[model samples]
Each structure stands twice: as structure tokens, then as C-alpha cells.
Target: MYWSVDEVDATPYFSKTMSRNRFQIIWKFLHYNDNANLDVNDKMYKVRPVLDYIVEKFKQMYQPDKNICIDEGMMLWRGRLSFRVYNPQKPVKYGIKSYILCDSATGYCFNMRPYFGEGSSLPDTMFSLLDRLSGHGYTLYMDNFYNSVALCERLLEAQTNVCGTLRKNRGEPQVIRDLVKTDLGIGDKVVRHNDKVMVVAWQDKRLVKMVTTCHQDGMQKVDVWQKGHKDKVAQFKPECVVAYKSHMNGVDKLDQNISYYPFIRRSLNWSKKFVAYLFQMCMFNAYILYRARNPGGCNTLLKFICSVVKSWTLKVHERKGSELGEQVEEEEGAGVEDGDLEDVKHTLRAPYNTDPESRLDGDLGRHKLCYLKPTSKKLRPTKRCRVCIRRGTRRETKMMCKVCCVPLHAGQCYIDYHTTVRYSVSVQG
Candidate 1:
């Protein structure tokens, strides 16, 4: 719609701000890290700078509330990556995974860590995520994946509290485990406690087990609707269950807000897609801070994002428009003589010969062999092999070097053209 010419499909806001070609070119060449200085050990070295900077800024900008939550968020990717994860429960079933910590009240993300496969220890991951807020008396809520009885005790030692559903075998009290196996009716409850943490197994539709370091064992009355009853009825439930339900959606809320106006799109490169996800996170965090300072202001997330886009493109649009017009005028004014016209035509038809030293010095991977795509329905694209043409023999092929933009036959012709300084001599020999 950005570049559509039809009346109904055209979006003037997009067309006026930036041309589609320019946007694509920018996306194509976007880079964050220097290839020469990359750390071979780190899997995400390509985008580490931007990722680290964003994470630091997120923590520096805002302090989270007392009640906070941790959860896993997925960045949709199905490429051949070493650390990609699959979780059927997530809306994006296959993608790169990241652990995120967010404020329960405002849904602001404070920290995030990309999963580096089984090498990363769960306990260490939790401690790294909560490094800044460890001793601040804040409560952390999460799902069974991150909640273990040992982890809860560890957090309590750092003056932090944890409340979340626990896995059956995560060193919960044996008594609670036996209780879980027993058949119980709805709202039936069993509680066990040590000096530090409390384990509760409550029976709802099925058995639900949870561990908490900071919730009372007392029951609270809540209105719940049951089958065969039209009106809601009051039922006594565990206080920890209520608190867990209320506060365990911080990361989910953050994901929901980011999903509303996603900046990411389909891409072959996982690094680029991950970078776009980081940018979206930064935008969401900015929106949170914006709403915080201006509670009554006319700034919804959509409006804020639009304003940011407009501000970024306003100057670039005017400058690029003028530059394009000047270039067009120059092309129109210049005239080619009859003698030079053929040379111009040849230059347009064949690739200009590049410097041989630079072409042969680097890794062979730098030069890509690609099939010549057909430009028109009636014609198949072909070019005279540069090496064959030089050796007094004409050859045509549907294969070309992407970097050099010169056609060559696959075997000896392609190798000689890139490797030999005088490829014609090599062909003759």
C-alpha cells in the first residue's frame, strides 16, 4: 500500500514520507557490528551491541513495582539457527526465545536475555535477570519453567520473594506431592511449609500445585461461576492462587502491547529479524515511560509510534526528494554523441570489469553465483561469458557472479575469471 498507484490501495502518508525502494535499500544494508572485531565465542555477536545498549537503557529508565513477573517471549524465526526453540503453547510456535522480566503493574520490560541453548543454567539465568533488583524486597512471579523450591529459597535469601506454579518434581515437599496424587473435589486444599517457603496443592477442575515465599496460607473469598449455576457464587480460595493469577501476566502484557503494531517482517536473516524485535521492544518501553509521565496526555501507543516515525522521516523525505529531482534533471540535460552511444549501450549490457587484485584477494564466498532471473515473460536473461568472449569464442549462460555482475560458465570459466589476472591467457593455455 505504501507504493500503490491505485486510488483505494494508496497510502499518501507512506508515499509522501519515503519511497519504497529507498526503504528497502536501507533495510538491505543495515548493520550494527563490525565484522572484523566479532567475538567468535558468542552466538549473538552480530547484534550484541544494540541488544546490550537497549537492555541497559531499559533498566536505567525506570524502576519496576514491588510485584513483577518473569516469562519467556518468542521472536518468530524458522531459519537454520543453532539455538532456535519450539514451544507449542506460544502463539509463535517456532522462534528464537528470550527470557523477559517486566513490571506487573505497568508492563514495562526491565531486562531480557536470549537463550543460548542448554549451556545456560536456569538458576544463573534467573540471578542474572534479577541482578539489579535482587535486594530490593520485590516479589517475582513466573510459571513452572522458572519456579523451583530451591530457586524460591535462593531468592528469599537475597531479600526477594517468589510466587509461581511449581513443577511436580522440582523438590517440592513430598507431602504436597502425595497430596497432589490423591483425588480431591473442587476447592479442596492442602498446605505444607518449611522455615522459608510454603507449598500448596489446591484442587480446582484438576490439581494445581504452587510454591510461594511471601503469601499467607489463609483463604480468600472470590466470586466464581460454576456449571449449572447461572449467577456467580462466592468460593474460598488460597490467597497465593489469587495473587499469582493477578500478577503473573506482566510479560504477557508486554508481548501483547508489542504485537499490536509489529515492526518486524519476514526475513531470511535471523540477526536482522532479532534486531527488529529489539527495536520494537525499545519502542514499547518508550511508550510505557511516555504514559507514565503524562498520565492524562493524548498519547496512546499507536499515536506515539506514528509521531516518532513522522519525525524521523520528515527531513529525510525533503532532502531525498530534492536530490532525486536534481539527478533527473542532470540525466535529461546530458546528451551522448553517436560514437559514444554504442559504448554506453555495451556498458549497460555487460558488467564493467572490476580490479582483479581485489576480486581474487578475499574469500571465495564474497562472490556469489546466482541464476540470471528473467526480466520479461518472453525473454530468458543470458550474457556472453567474459572469459570465453576474450578467447575468441562466444558463449552464453544463464549464470552470473552477483558481486561482479559478469556471466561465466560454471566450472573452469568461473574459476579462471575470478582467480587468474589474465583469464584469456589461462583459457588459451
Candidate 2:
């Protein structure tokens, strides 16, 4: 159960020549056999079957005491070399989009899919995760991107429950009448829904009527009035007539250590793509497996792994005076020795040994995180390779999330209050 890329890279078995900095390199070799001629897409296709293998392995490895909360997320991808896609509405760089299904309770990744270009069937972004789980009756949560009358109907057919943000301008129209005195509008038999909400204004005051499939949730019998909030007048606040189950997006789960291999990734043909995907899935699954071993801790499994890597990297320094070491020192000044370097290392360790405040507190999760912790340590050791330290600090170097490159622990990534409460319901394209 390794946590960081450094750990994965440090494994004695990997070829010495392999570049640990770019994880995609390792993935490329494992998936494509270090063959430059083979196509990347072809590798991805071959990797699909590995998913089935992972599913079997997952079932055998962990037997949950109870049904776990499963949530799905997707990443949009284009060709490897490019970052943008050709969407007239919003074009993005050519890259890969990944879809993931995570066990909310454990914050472990259960399944993942790497998408290339847009194609038919496209796994129905609305129901992609459901398709992967191969079961029903589960409560699925998503943003407005997955909202649709047809998809809702499908969920009903499967006996699965779903609660998501409603798409704007996609609701049934209501007829309301403005009566003599009150600005309130009366609708036809509106049922009582929410226990409390502010009424901003009335449309017609009288003859208020609304059509909605959600009427059964006990909202059909109350007065359906269009209320405006102080935030925005154009957008009306939703006033549910009945008490419906309020579904929220589960807390942010662990983040996967991912890398973008823009150049080589795009050149792959179908055959190579399949094979590469197989390797990608295997490695990602390995990442999830690693996280499962550690329940709660600072830094994610990915961060842990990277820490191990940094520690192991010290071993490279251990090989001082060796042929490779000499060349490294000559070619890269980072390997050069300095008298004060050791003193700096010792000073940093003193607090961990003598002072409690300097020690890691286990209460980071409770601090109400302001933003994902910075990837780079504000202060760095002067003796260590600045390049290596830079990798740890740079958003791109950490093969995890842009917000925080550290490896994932057992639970999902931390999210802010606004994102959890509001944006959780709305879907993204």
C-alpha cells in the first residue's frame, strides 16, 4: 500500500532508466512495452478487460460490513498533445477525461474510465457510474449535467433513487393569478413541500398552477408562487410544496494520482490505446488498493507515496561518489554538497523531537480547510535538490490534483462549504 509516486518509482524492480518524474512514462512502458511505434489508443482498448479483472479483485479483497456509498465523477479528455477540444460553446485543450466511481464511505476508487474523443453511446454521462456498478436501487448523486426527464425515468425503471440539481428552464410551466390584495399568487392544489422558505413575490397572485413530475413528492397542493431572492432577480428561488428527500453530494473523496501525457498519448492508434489503457487502469487500481490500507491520515495515499519517494530519493544521495552520482553532481548542481546542508536537516528535525507544536496534528480534517493545502512547502531545505523540491511544489509535478498534488488518503479530497452545499447539485459538461 504505497502512497506517493516516489514510492511507486522507488520499487527496486522498475528499470533504472525509467523517469519517475513523469508517471506517464512508467504507464507508457507498462502499457506499451517501451515500444515507440505502437499507438496509444490501441493500448487503451486492450486495458478495458483489466477493469473486469479489477472488479473481481475488488470483490475478493474487501467485504464491506454494509453497503457502501458509491459516487461517480468524470474527466473530459482530448488527444494527448492537445489540451483543448472543439466545442463551439467551450473548447478545451486536447487531453484525457477520466470517469471515476468511488466508495463514499471508504473514499476508495471502485472503478475508472479514461475517455478519448467523443463517440457514440459515450457511456451516457448521466448513467455512466450506474452502468459500471452493474446493480440498482442505489441512491445516486450528480450535478445538473445528469438531469433529464428521460434519465430520471430510467432511474425509476431500475428502481434506483436519484436526487440532483434541476436544470434551469427545464421545469414544467405553472399558471398563477395575482389577486386583489396580497402579492402572493395562488396555484392549483399545491401540496406542502418544504417546511420553510422565504416567499419573495408573486407572479399572478391567483390562478397559480405548476406542472412537474415531482408533484408526487407532496408539492402539488400549495400555492406555487415565483419568488425572487436578493442574490439575483432573474433566477427565482425554488419553493418546494412538499417535503422531498434533500439529497446532497457526498463529501469530496480521495483524489487519484493522475498525469497528462499529451504528446505520446495523442499519437497512439487504436491498438496501442487499448494496451495503454490497460496499464493505466492497473496502476490506478493499485493506487486505490494502497489507499484502502490507510483509513485516516494527513496527506492522501498519493502524498504518502510521494513522501516515501522523497525519502527514497535521499538514497540516491546515499550513492555519493559512485559513477552515476559523480555525473549527476557534475550535470546537475542539485547533487552538489554543501557544509550547512546537514545542519538545516538537523534543525528541522529538532522540533519534531523536542516540541509538540511542530509535530503533525491529526485534526487537519476538522480545521474547515480554506483551500486544498499548498503543494509546495513554504520553506525548503537548502541542501536538497531545488529541482526535486520544485517538483513537489509545482502544480504540474504532483501527479494528483491541481489544487493539491499530495497523494490521497482513504477519504476523498476536502471540499469547501459552498461547493458541498450549492454546486453539488449542478452538473458539469
TM-score of each: 0.71, 0.38
**lDDT (10s digit) by residue, model 1, range 102-209:** 999988999999986757678899989997999999999999998899989999999999999998789987777777445677888888999999999999878999
What TM value does model 2 have?
A: 0.38
**Tens-digit lDDT track for model 2 on 23-80?**
6664555552335454565434444455557655655554332222333332334434
What local lDDT does model 1 show for residue 124?
A: 90
Candidate 2 residue runs with Cα over 4 Å from true position: 1-43, 46-94, 105-107, 117-128, 131-136, 168-303, 306-429
Runs in model 1 lying further than 4 Å from the true structure: 1-10, 317-429
lDDT of each: 0.82, 0.37
How many steric overlaps are in each model, in order? 0, 91
Residue-level error in angstroms, candidate 1, position 256: 1.1
